[model samples]
Target chain A: MSPTCKLTYFDAMGIGEPIRFLLCYGKIQFEDIRFDFEKWPSMKPSTPYGKVPLLEIDGKKMHQSAAICRYLGKKLGLAGANDWESAQIDMAVDTITDLRLKVTEYYWEPEETTKQKKKETLLNETLPFYMEKLDALVKENGGYLVAGKLSWGDFFFAGVSDYMDCVVQFDITKDHPNLAALKKKIRELPAIKEWISKRPKTTL
Target chain B: MSPTCKLTYFDAMGIGEPIRFLLCYGKIQFEDIRFDFEKWPSMKPSTPYGKVPLLEIDGKKMHQSAAICRYLGKKLGLAGANDWESAQIDMAVDTITDLRLKVTEYYWEPEETTKQKKKETLLNETLPFYMEKLDALVKENGGYLVAGKLSWGDFFFAGVSDYMDCVVQFDITKDHPNLAALKKKIRELPAIKEWISKRPKTTL
Candidate 1:
């Protein structure tokens, strides 16, 4: 019997979306509980870490997005074939996370001067640096993040890039054709495709 | 025979130190390459992720401090006994990382006003929130971060808290007595104790 799974996150395709996408791709059934931003203030006190994207497996709740993803990735046979390959995939996922945090900081900056400065840096420096590096990795790794095949890192990065796109409001994929293609490929997967068709729409 | 390992990072006990502590605790011999801040600009471009704490297994390099730590944690039998326990450990490690990044942002913030604001939040809210949660985990898990015995999460958090302390200049553990005990227990391990005695000291 499959384990009962439930996920809680704010109503947006933020970090929580990756876990949803992964579960959908694995054909695993889970309750997707999304709430509005206003609800988070009250909900915060009840969360596992006062954070969203909490996953309940067999009634036991777990926090940490990457950890939940890794567990699901391992369970779904999407992590990697062996320990070394798993480490490589983990490296790629964390690298994408590093890139995500950098981008998110720009989105979260409250002051106008700092926000403009960060946007310039993101557009000119940070995006180019990470895009070039990761684009090359995708090209070299046979269109996937690691081991020349599909892994959780691919889905994770693909989901993260969507959030990045929302933050930057620029066609980030224009330069990184390979990564763009990879994202398209991930979206085209049967399970993911179906989920995308049915999943709730949100501006973010 | 064991694999030949070489670790390259700046001449500081920052990200690289955890990798060292893990390797030392496992009694794993590795070449520790430390360079000063002056060398980083020239060195950065060659790194796997353009970041330090690069672990070279044999001759191939891998990046991402958490990924490297996870890899070393697995190889050293410090990950956990099984996948479930491993997931729990991963959860704890990533939570600490989230805490670390939040604290480090204060250290990295350049604008005086922003820095002061972040510092105020750190002192009044953030540190206490994480410390209480994690300290409870240590106490509940029988004196370790996960499981009843030592795990990599213990060492990783202990290492990270030292970095956190360097950034905040506060005795974060003064109120969280259990976490303080956990840190002490991790430090008292023979290998880590020896490494601490001999390793070059850096403020951060």
Candidate 2:
């Protein structure tokens, strides 16, 4: 029998969404448990490392979104065909993570003036720098993120794209045709399409 | 013959050290190319993704420190015994990364008052929170970060511990005996000990 799977996170398409995408893509059944921000203070201490997007497989809990996604990717046969390919996938995902951290920094800036300055830098410089490189990579890899095929790295970007845009308040993929196309392709996958259609809607 | 390997990074431990530790631990000889900050402006553009700690194996370059370390970890047989074990190692490494980010945030804060505030919180709350948990984990896992044996996670933490201490202005492992012991053990390994003695000294 399949191991019982439960995922707990806030009710938003943040880091947790990538794991959800992978589970759905692999046709795995999981209980998705989401809570509001108000409950986080009480919930935080109980977490393994005081963070969210936790996955429990067969009563064994694990933290870290990227780690969980990678685990599932390997299990689902979407990680890579071999070690080198997996490394390429990891590199792509880490690059995506680097860009996401910038957006997060801007989002979490408390002061308006500082936030605006970060916003300008992000939109004009950082986004383009990353998107262009990522675009060229996808184009070279035949519309996928790494190793010339679909991997968890693709799902990671697709899963996090909406939350990132919501935080940055911009269409991050506006000019990056390849990134936009990749997102479209992932969203159009049968399981992912169904998951998106049924997943709970949240402001961010 | 071993692939011609080249690693390029700034002349400090930083993220580059983990890869160095892995290579040295595996006894693989490679070119360690270090550069001063003044040269980075011109050098950045030449990097695979405009970052350092870039590893080129047989002329194929890769980016992202964690990704590179993972790749090297797998190749050097320090990753894990199997898929689940690798996932556990990834989780531990990611958790360590989370704490490192907190230290980095405190280190990079510019305003004195804000920096002091962050420092107080870090020392009083964040450090203890993570250290206690990690100390317990190391104890449980037989003085290693994951899987009751040595892994890249150990190399990663040991390699970065000094840099982390330099940034935080605290001996992070002072009270964590298991963590301290793990670092000492990794450092005392023959190749790692040799690498440490021969490595270029820098203030970080």
Candidate with maximal TM-score:
2
Per-model TM against the reference? 0.96, 0.96
Q: What is the DockQ (computed on Cα atoms) for candidate 2?
A: 0.88
Candidate 1 ranges beyond 4 A from true positions: A1-3, B1-3
Model 1 misses residue B131 by how many Å?
Answer: 0.4
**Candidate 2 per-residue C-alpha lDDT over B1-204 given as tens digits, one digit per residue, 9 for 90 to 100:** 655998999998888888899999887789999999789999999887888889987467788888888988988888999878898889988888888888888987998998999999989999899999999999999999887999999999987787788887677999999999999999999999999999998766
Write the residue-wise lDDT of candidate 1 on A91-186 in tens digits.
Answer: 998898888888988998898997999999989998999999999999999999898999999889877787788888876777999899999999
Worst 10 residues of 2 chain B by lDDT: B57-66
True contacts kept of 1: 0.78
